[model samples]
Target: MKVPKRVYEGLEAVRSSGRTNMLIVSDVLRCARSMGYPETAQWIEDNRNPYWEGIFQGFSPSD
Candidate 1:
């Protein structure tokens, strides 16, 4: 599944902000799912950090 460049870039920006939490990540994933980007959502879910802060890093389509 191919994710749009804008969507991928937005996700990367959010992940790089250094202020994300699980709730924010969940909201992002939910939005992705709702916007017909299940693969992107799943990619986010798979790559999110396990810690409470900095919920995501190294956002990439090949990860």
Candidate 2:
């Protein structure tokens, strides 16, 4: 799924600020709901496998 730039930016912002996985997911879900994208929020909530991983793994700090 193609993520909107705003959503990507929001998640990136959260990560850059050192937010945890839970907070990042919460941010995404809240953003999606407030932006009238319940499907995206629900998809995030429902998909356990690679859900949080997919959202956050890309932003993991590299050593």
Candidate 3:
């Protein structure tokens, strides 16, 4: 069976840019949302300003 075009495109992008940490990132984003973190999503992505790196340490970024 053939994969959908968007999935294929996503795979291609991952293939080229090696962003294997996407799953971890997505999970963190979900958790942030459930906790009512912020709006733009980018709102919680900051480490030096808003969200600290320590806050994200528990989330393993391993694939």
The lDDT leader among the candidates is 2
Better of 1 and 3 by lDDT: 1
Question: For this target, which candidate reaches the highest TM-score against the unseen true structure?
Answer: 2
Candidates in order have lDDT scores of: 0.53, 0.55, 0.39
Question: How would you encode candidate 1's per-residue C-alpha lDDT over 25-56 as one tens digit per residue?
Answer: 67777666655667657766675543223333
Query: Runs in model 1 with CA error above 4 Å?
Result: 1-23, 50-63
Which residue pairs in model 1 clash with each other? none
Error of 3 at 36 (Å): 1.0
User: TM-score ranking from best to worst?
Assistant: 2, 1, 3
Error in Å for residue 40 of model 3: 8.2
lDDT per residue as tens, model 3, 1-63: 123343333333433455344446565555445444434234435433333342334222222
Residue-level error in angstroms, candidate 2, position 38: 0.3
Worst window of 10 by summed lDDT in candidate 2: 54-63
The collision pairs in model 3 are none
Superposed Cα deviation of residue 50, candidate 3 (Å): 11
Candidate 1 vs candidate 3: the TM-score winner is 1
Q: lDDT at 2 for candidate 3? A: 29
Estimated TM-score for each candidate: 0.45, 0.46, 0.28
RMSD to true structure for each model, in Å: 6.5, 6.6, 13.4
